[model samples]
Target: MSMERIATALDRVSAALRRKPQAGIHDDAAATARWDGGLRTRVLHDAGHELLTDMPAEIGGEDGAPTPGWFMRAGLASCAVTRIAMAAAAEGIRLETLEARASSRSDTRGMLLIPEADGSAVPAQPLEIALHVRIGAPGVPAERLRTLVEWTARCSPVGCTVEQPMPLALHVDVAS
Candidate 1:
């Protein structure tokens, strides 16, 4: 979509929220994933979209697709870029280039039940995720560009979700 269109949509949503804050609040995203026997076959469904996740052969998968962590990183990177663009549009900045690099670091000791190099236990998940965003817009000041990037990081949904911890509940059911 064009930047003008995106700005218009954002303005519309902002107006709606301002008019009825409570009515505008919603959280109803639902996705289901099903896993079959081998090859790290996991199919996820959300709304009308479907995503397949798999692991590499080194970890016992057929390398059919990217791992779940990879997907998460990609989502973060995509969200950062989109949010930056949205901010730029709102601020009337014509972006010439925008690039976001997202990376995560994890230790296999936790999943593989191996000891850490220092004889300590590794965390159950990745230790850190990093996002490096570079943006360019002619005639825009460097300070304004930095502010846009900072604002995007503050408000991006995926980035916020990754930084914060939320309550989770799990249940298992068996069929006869």
Candidate 2:
């Protein structure tokens, strides 16, 4: 059996006064290559379980985990930070720091790890992610950072996740 996902992001958004930005999105995933020369150690992904605990303690975290979700943990943070950096660079604003953290919960009454519909064992959906980003843009006004947030909200992967509903698309591209 095979699973297929379809995704389409608007290249242009509507604007009241001027034309909106030109941007697009594709699909991606978190995994390592199947082959390596000598080192072949497997790594666990933080996905939903360990996403919250994989951060520094000074920045709102306890920092306890067995190397969880190293791949997905920074998915949103990196993307969002990159966008902010780009915006700041474009405006000649210097940045000092950037960070992202995430937490999540499901409507399972705090019982099941993943809520199931129709008593099916399979996971019905991904839980909600409470994501936050802290960016230190020196010499940049707060209003400009707000604009950067707006732009990232429309462009970054994590930003898109926060904007609309849950995940509705998945794609695995590979050829050999």
> Which pairs of residues have clashing backbones in candidate 2?
45-69, 46-69
Per-residue lDDT of 1-176 in model 1, one digit per residue for the tens? 88899899999999989999997778767677678557565555565777778877888888888888888899899999999999998877899999999998998668777877788887867888899999999998999999899978999999998898686788889978
Candidate number with greatest lDDT = 1
> Per-model C-alpha lDDT, please?
0.86, 0.51
User: Which portions of model 2 miss their true places by more than 4 Å?
Assistant: 1-70, 106-124, 161-176
Q: What lDDT would candidate 2 get against the real structure?
A: 0.51
**Which lDDT tens digits does candidate 2 get at residues 63-85?**
55322334444666677776666
Clashing pairs in 1: none
Give, for candidate 1, the lowest lDDT window spanning 10 residues: 36-45
TM-score for candidate 2: 0.47
